[model samples]
Target: MTLRHSLLLATASLIVSATVAMAQEPEVDCDNAQTQMDMNICAGRDYKTADNELNAVYKKALEAAKETDEGFKDMGEQYVGAVDALKRAQRSWIGYRDGQCELAGFEARGGSMEPLLVSSCLADLTRKRTAELKAFYEQEN
Candidate 1:
């Protein structure tokens, strides 16, 4: 009933919870993820890798778009330049990706596998988008 006792109980509960959590957590092996948590973690890592590559390629695409727009600068306000068009398309693509991934997660619904599904979808979509951006940049170059 005392505040001191309450604080002590809370602290003990926290410590116990932390210990249990640590015990339950497995060492993730992405190559052969067996547990749900490990699979989720691996899927997240895949998404991160794809996102990083997408970001790098996107920067290159932006730069290429800028270069391409240089010739159009003289056309004044009448033209929608390459950089502007690319930015607009990229923004739309991001929205589409997030929505599509969220929809993919619905297969798992409220289950533990939802995150893994969403992450895998994101990774796949991001890699595909990165390829598209790379191809656009190459074509423009």
Candidate 2:
């Protein structure tokens, strides 16, 4: 009934609501995919998406840094390096994912559906990577 008590209750309610909203958000699980191929594919997708988001955020930050301080303009070079690294990692991951998935399909040292398995694996990897990047960017934003 008191003003102080009512304000305290309102603040607690807001905190609880915010916590629930965050907890209800979806999470990605590439490791637990139904098939090995699916897992790889999801991981690949997740990486690619993350790469894209990282690049976008870096670009925005570079621009903002430039505007805020002329001396900071050179920091864009750092962003460029980060972008390059992410891209390189993504490419290497693609190769590793496919190779691993194809190797998994070996029943008698080689299988007919190896290609399909590789594709699915790549997709699963990508999905998982994308989810990770989404989380990173979401935090930054």
Scored by TM-score, the top model is 1
lDDT of 2 by residue, 20-123 (tens): 98666344466676764555456556645655664565556444434444444467744434444545665786687667766755632454345445555555
How many residue pairs clash (N, CA or C atoms closer than 3 angstroms) in each of the candidate models, in the order given?
A: 0, 29
lDDT of 1 by residue, 1-141 (tens): 999999999999999999999667456889988889889989988999999999999999999998888867788856647888999999999999999999999999999999999999999999999999999999987
Worst 10 residues of 2 by lDDT: 64-73
**What is the TM-score of each predicted model, taking all chains together?**
0.80, 0.39
In model 1, what lDDT does residue 94 have?
98
lDDT of each: 0.93, 0.58
Candidate 1: segments with Cα more than 4 A from true spot: 1-27
In model 1, what is the error at residue 36, expressed in angstroms? 0.7
